[model samples]
Target chain A: MNFKLWVKPFENLAKKDRFTISILWVAMVLAYWLITTAGEKKFFPTPLQVWQGFAALYSEGLVVHIGSSLWLCLQATVISIVVSLVIAYSYPIPLLRPLSRAMSQLRYLPLTGITFYLTILVTNARTMQVWVLVIFMSLYFITSLLAVIKDIPQEEIDHARSLKCNRWEILWEVIVKGRFDYVIDVLRQNLAITWMMLVTVESILVAAGGLGVLIKNSDKFMNHGRIFALQIVILLVGLSIDYTLNTTRKSLFRYSKFN
Target chain B: MNIQYEEKDIILQVENLSISYGEKVIIRDVNFIERNVVRKEINQGQVVAVLGRSGRGKSTLFRALTGLVKPSSGKVLIPDYSQAPSNGMQPAKEVEEGDVGFVDQKYTLFRHKTIYDSLTFALRKSGEKGSEKKEKVMKYLIEWGLEKVKDQYPNELSGGQRQRVAIIEQLLSSGHYMVLDEPFSGLDIGNIQNARQSFKLIENGHDLNTIIFSTHDIELATELADSIYVMGYPRLDDGSLGTVGTIVRHFDLKALGIAWRTEFTQDHLELVKEIKSAMLAS
Candidate 1:
């Protein structure tokens, strides 16, 4: 094969595609640098200061804080998901309807404002923090899952029943399998809310070694660079989780693309 | 009137079947002495079609037959193969899964499963094992020309493909009989012809698979059904709604020289007209 012939295909990209691929990241970085360094009395930390703060925090073991926060969030998320699934699936029974209704109404109560009540109930600070996060996140979980469960077409259930599936089989084959992708989507969306509530939860329980505690300590000492750096870390972690979830959902439900 | 078939040939019997929702009766005294009592005998290998307009209880009747809906006072009798306790009587009981395969109007295939997996799941449910399960699934896939899309999910297939897969899945799972609710509603002409061919093939190949599908299309029903059951809203003597759907007419097409290949002649058109009138009659 001639060298030019092989190179011609590679050079066939549109000007717009080339600009987007090469220039978008550089432009974003330049914008960030200008915004952080332009002012005389800096409200935001300079990029150099933020980078140094990140290095200092890393040397002092900030990974422990990140790990603890992530572990707590994961635990609360798994518990809330299981409980929400139970509530949503049992919503049809008349006896459970009132309980579900009560929970739905409770979602309107502000999560952070209820910290004192949770503290009173569970005096141990760490336990109280976990409880608050679980309760806060589960409200959204229950509501979203209830909507998903309700949106399951009756025909799908009847189809499973017609195939000789008993109640449990219908739950597994129809409800779970049918809503698998949507459930992951719901989790991905609600996980952002959970992370937003994490700082509030961990700040209340100062002894808890998490990013929220680090942010709280930084806030108290007027360490603006450390605050900005920790916030950036949190954002990156959240975005990474979201990207992973999105990729998983796409791969698992490739068939949905054709529809 | 009781239309009796020989006991050995009888595949299903709806005995005095009356179904009601609260006080509003949908099928009142389906096979009793009262008015609107439907007495019919379905034999093995017959393609029966129930024709009716919307809300005429055709689907309700099918639901009752398949044991999805509980009848108010009557029962649907299917041969209880599990209970042959040497009483010299093959007792009949309510329909159960593996007894009657049902396909709804929307061809509800498992979205998560591929065509091959769906068939294998059905076979597995019926206790087929290992190579036998794979062989049966492959056989049907080849037989129906579905081998090409065997690994594709239901959403990846066309509407016609989904319907065929639904029918084939039901056939493999529930071998003896199948009930379909509005199986041909949304299908195009090409798909309808394809469906007809599949049904014909199943009927000819399997000696025991009796297909019962409900539809409002008079022409399609008349063409496919060996016997047609016309359901309509019954009217009392005083010009009031009878609160139930009754069989207005039952046509044994074979007796009238109607076959799968029967051309639409003047007599057939007349019969279609009569069925339409009966379906619409108060």
Candidate 2:
């Protein structure tokens, strides 16, 4: 009965999606338990050991590191979104088209290679890291948003104009409102990149105190349990954030439920 | 053909309207005639259908009427309501909100907004506020049998429902005139009939609203339009094909004793054949 109750929620999911998610979850947990317990070399710590490490870090005030990292990611993401919107919307204008096209090409440049130059350009390490992340995220964001904007139906713009909408009104009504779902989807897709760069930047700037710094400190002491715990924390945090964004998108664009 | 309505009763006029894209002319020298009078004007509350085959510039004519496509040489005239019209006609470009409403082939609706909100948003844009807007929306929702789907977003509705909503939104926003571009293309017979009924209800014998729609369906045009404008490519006097699309035939269905709600008898079918042949010949 309890199994039936628990499975009821998943009944609405597509059979294939349900199957995929169930198999992946079970396999991941099984592999984690088996590999940690059966290993003689103690290469991977047990789940209990990792849990103990998490508890210790939690009591030692790990929230500060998590909060700082989240704050920095939030700031960079907001800036990237604002800048990308401006570039994507204005790209149709002849004067701005070349600049937008040139900036979009920057996505092909590796973030790691650019970080070296960015560090030199900005004196402060933390500021440099943020700028590097902003640049990387903004380029990705601009390209995705431009593609979304391009896909907006011409009929929608014409419809708005027929309703006496001027250029600015058409921009707000058709371009912004029509592409809103895609915008949210783009943000969700690029968020993974933002988290990846956040870890890389924080780890490289060793003086910065963040989740990446915590992981680095654990690595220095050769504490596999703490390292695994911090890794798990980052994974969980990233997953939760992604889940929140998905929920937000679904809730805000409830009409998409039919689609 | 010469069709005339009183100057005060006419809502729209197209005067030697021609449209072209750079070196290519899409439509040229298109004109409509009043059945009796000398003035070539579409009377208020009259349904006008532009009939043509695909790519014969029916959609282009509609676009020019809506001012989306600028006319190459001539002008589309709508009555200017801002001032007492000196000539009873103003250029189509001068037509604003509350003057013309257009529904394209896609039946475009705001996917994010509910049917109720879509109506209210249009009203708000036209400067309506508060209880008046809500009252008007509710009244139309019930009148159109869309009350059940009032709170549902556009995507949740069926195609016919969405089309109805689009029509109602246009009617509420700009009631004076409407141009529907191929509104019956993908619809089933039942929905098409329902759409016709909706158009009839809006026109309502009051001669206040005017509608112009384009369709390739001869039967539909014969049934719905008070005056039918057949657009096609014509042979030019220079012994070469005319590049511009022009009105090849203009006639009033009522004047020919065709009733709007009459069954499709053999006579009606013959009329349809004649129109089809005329369309092809042009």
Candidate 3:
């Protein structure tokens, strides 16, 4: 790996917004230190204690919890994408439009409440919760897809037709080309939301080990420090996931107008 | 109205073609035979203008000609429809391969796509390969005065620039039968001239297609049309839009109006002038 490639973006960032950006960074660090230190005894251990906990957790099969949550989120997200594509393609047809719209509106209901309500119907609450997680997020994904498709200009369609492109070719070529920027934009904005949904579902529904389970179990004994430390881990994990997704989207959609 | 062709062959024959939206009929029983259509056949080398007032169905006529719209009652037959319509002229059904190029009225560039990508997409669809597509699309862009704005997105360009991009895109596609819907609307003189130049190049360079378009500008129509079809008039009692005043004037209005007294405004007054003068003097 060329360390220089990694350093170039920081160098440009420094030149562009050096003063305000550095000040903001320093402020954030100071704020984090104070919050973690002040709550060291009751809620969080000291910064040093948190570090030691991280070191200790690394050897104590913490990997299982991390891996499981990561796997579930990935699974849920993939399911969401497929479901979204189905909704997008189906909703445009006259017969399915009303049903798709109704389902999309229902997605706004509180996830926890829906999970609890659905639990009565299914024998296994965890499985139902996972499916519900996928379905709920998929509704949002479908809405975004619809917006992207609808926003494509009619001229592109006409141009495609004049060129003798079949209906399918028009969809794949002009319409897709026209609205690709919005699709990438929607994906970028929703990466964090997907992770948040994953953690929320895992925390409330999963019987097995996950970061959520650790936090919940720690909460039972009122071990506030461990709960706070678990949250830090979750935050870092969510950030890493978001960063990876954004970078990938930016690279893939480089030809898109937004770049 | 019956259309008689003396010598010119009818390229597009619209027999009693009428269009309606719900209950209101927009144009009814329109009839005409274009002159020199056989001898002056475009061979894909001519540009024709369809000029009319707003709401007169100029765009509708273009769509009807291209079979995008189903006429209420009539037939549109493209006589001598080219076997290999130029590339990028996909209609609902694959008739013969009569390609038609369309520049939509709206500024329909993909807002998120860079100029490079937009042109690339159009060129690739036209079966242009490798560096040829790039060279041709870029050549049109430069010729149409889009070199400075080549890297910009649709949103980044001005209205004229965006429209030129749309024009260049269609030009690169290189369809034989080109139909532009008010291509000069909202453009300044220079952009309009540039767009016209680009269109002229397409027609002259590719002599396998005929171009048809609609506009509200009489000047443009007069400048570009090989034969003008002026279509703003009410149907007479006989269920035909009477001859255009210019065409009627050409046919000796006095002789044609002898049978219909009420229709002859000047002749009726001329006959009654002697009696009216005596009454006025008394």
Top TM-score prediction, candidate number = 2
- Two-chain DockQ for each candidate model: 0.47, 0.50, 0.21
Per DockQ, the best of the predicted structures is: 2
Q: Write the per-residue lDDT of candidate 1 for residues B179-258, one digit (tens) a residue.
A: 98998889999998888888887777655667889987888888887678877778788987666786767887655666
lDDT of 3 by residue, A1-259 (tens): 3335434754554344566667778999868877857842533467665666666566766789888788777777777777776677666567888877776787678877777767787767566656776877777877777777777666666666665566777666765655565665676566567766655677756566677677667768765456667778888998887677667766766545354
TM-score order, best first, reads 2, 1, 3
lDDT of 2 by residue, B1-282 (tens): 223343343456678888878888888888763321122342237678888766778988888777777778777776556566455543234444335788988899887788898898778665676888999899988998999999998878887888899888888777667899988989998998888888877666345577789887888788777778888888788766565689988767656756454466665677788889878777
lDDT of 2 by residue, A1-259 (tens): 1345446753566667667778989999879887867767666888777888899889866898899889888888888888998898887677888888888888999877888788778998778767887899999999988887777788887787777777887788777876687787899889888897766778767777889888878888988778889988898889988888888888988875522
Clashing pairs in 1: B30-B38
Candidate 3 lDDT, B1-282, residue by residue in tens: 222223333444556777776887766665544322222333334456665445556676676666566777766665444344445432223212114556777767655568877788766656657698788877877777788878877777877788777766656664555677888888888878776676667655554445677676644544454444544544467777533211110111122232112233444444334323322222
Q: What proportion of the real contacts between chains A and B does each prediction keep?
A: 0.52, 0.63, 0.37
Predictions: Cα RMSD each: 7.0, 5.2, 11.5
The best-first sequence of candidates by DockQ reads: 2, 1, 3
